[model samples]
Target: MGNCCVAGASSDMATFKWSIDNFSSLLDKGEGWTNSRVFKIMGHAWHLKLNPMDRNSCDEECVSLRLQLSKTSVEPNTIVDASFRLIIYDQLYGKDSEHHVSHTFQTASTSSGKSCMIKLAALKNSSGFLVNNNCVFGVKFIKVVTTKAKTTSEKLFVKNASTLPEAKAAYTWCIADFFGMENPGYSPEFTAGGYKWSIRLDKEENHISLYLKKMINDLPEDSAVLVEFTLSIKNQEGGKHLKKKGLTQFSNNDPTWGWEKVVSMEDIQDSSNGYLIKTKCCIEAEVTTVGSSKMK
Candidate 1:
C-alpha cells in the first residue's frame, strides 16, 4: 500500500504562513493591532473536531491574549528618561509574534516647566529578511520637558492713610498690640510720616467693601466716619445703675460737638456694657491688619 500524506501537514504550514501574513498586515496598518481576534483548536492524535468563529468566541480569546501580553510586556510605573528606547515582544512565541506590532518606545526628555512626547518603533531584523514585509513602524514626538514647581509670594500689606494722634493711639494699643501677640505675621511700623501695618486679604466682596478699609490705615476721600461713643452713668452714691440713670444721649444738638444723631436704643442690657462701639463719624481713617498666608 502507498503511504498516505498527512492531511494537515500542508494546510498547517499554509495556515502558519497566513498567520504571519496577517501579522505583517497589522504592522502596515499603523503601529498597533486594530483589534485582536481569537480562534480555538481541537485536533488530537486521531479524533477530529470543528472550531467555530463568533462574536463571543472572538471576545473571549482576544481578552485572554491581551491579558497575557500585558502581564509580560511592560512593568508598571517604569521611570524612563528622555530619549530612552523600549522593546515589546509577544510572549506567546519567543520569536517575534506573527503580529508586527511595535513592542518598544523611546521617551522624550523635557525641561522643568515643559511637556514631552514618546515615540514608538517596530522590531526588525538587520538582514533584508523582513524589509518591505510590513515588519516595522515608527512614531514621532513633539515637545518633551520635565515638570516644574509653582512659585508664589508671601502676603504684603500697604499703608493707605496718614496717621493721626488718636488713630495711632487706638491702633498701637488696641489693634497692633492685640494682633502682634495673637498674629505675629502682621507687621506694624511707625515713622515720622505715619504708622503703617500690613495684612493679607483676599479678593472677596465682603472683604473689599467692609473689612478692607477698616483693616488698612487709609480711608476713601468721600468716605463717611463711624465711631463708638459710650455713655457712663454713675450715681452720687457711688453705685452705677442703668434703670435709675435712664438713657444717655449724644446727637447733632450737642453744643460741644454734634455731627451724628443717636436716634434710639431698643435693646438695653444693664451689664457693664463696656463694649467698643462703632458709629459713622465725619472723620474717617483706613485701618489694616495682616492676615494669614494664602499659600500655606
Candidate 2:
C-alpha cells in the first residue's frame, strides 16, 4: 500500500524527531509495529510530564490557566452578551474536561473593566471564578465559545426642581442630594435648571435628612411648586469618569421631603469605596393667598 510519513519534533523533545505513517497492511496481519516506533508514538502523545521534587518545585510547575474574550471598544453602561467554552486536558489521563462560562458585558462605570454590571453565570467550578484586582479568570483551556453583543437602556433619576408662581404661601420643594453621600453640594450656578436656590446644608452628618422652609412670601396657601434636579455620586479615586445613574422617591410622611433609603442605593455602581444616594421629591402644590400683604 502507498504510504506517506509526516515528521516533526515532539513538543517538549526538540532534540528528538518522530513520524506518523499509514500502516494498515501491518495492522491487518495482527502484528504490532516495531518497539522503536511505539516508543516514538508514546513520546509524541506526552512530550513532557511535569515533575515536582519539593514545595518550591510544585509551585513552579503548577499550571495556571485563563481565558479572555477579544477586546472591544464599548460605550459606558452598554450591555453586551458574552459566552465561552474551555477544555481542560489532563495529560496524564489523556482525557479532556469541558467547562462553559458566560457573562453580559457592561462598560466599566468606574475603573476600566475593574467592575462589570452584568452578573456572570455558567461556571463549571464556582471556586475557580474570581474577580480579584479587576481580573476575571476561568480554569483550563478555552475553546468553541460564542458571545452576542447587546445594548440595553437603564433609567436613572437625575435630580429635582420646583417652580412657584409669583404669589407663594409655603413653597415647599423636595430636592434629593445624591452626590456621594459624603460630599453633597449645591452647584455654584443652577445650570442644571429651573431654580435660583441655595443649599440649606452642604452635607448630611448622620442619617439622610431633609428640612423644609418657605423660599418666597406673598402668604398664599398651597401654591403650585415644581421641583427637579439631578442625582450624582463620585466614582473611586481613579474612576471619576464613569457615569452613574440615580433614582429618587418621595418619603412617606413628608411628601415634600425626599431622602434615599440606604438599602435601595446598594447597586448604583461597583464602588470600591463610596456612598450612594437617591433623589427624593414631591409633586407640585396649588397656591392660595392667606395674608393681605403684597411685598413684591
Candidate No. with top TM-score = 2
Residues 116-235 of candidate 1 have per-residue lDDT tens digits of 111122234322224443222111121122233344444423333353334422222223222123321232432212223222212221211101112233433322223222212222
TM-score of 1: 0.18
Best by lDDT: 2
> Scored by CA lDDT, what does every candidate get?
0.23, 0.28
Q: How close is candidate 2 to the true structure, as a TM-score?
A: 0.24
Please write out the lDDT profile of model 2 over residues 1-296, one tens digit for every residue.
22122233333212211221232232334422222111122111112111111112223211122222222423454444433333333323434344454554444421111111112221212233221211122122122222344444333333222332444332323445454333543322221122233333234333333322223332233322323322233333434422222222222222232334322333433354333223432212223222121112
Local lDDT at 284 for model 1: 17
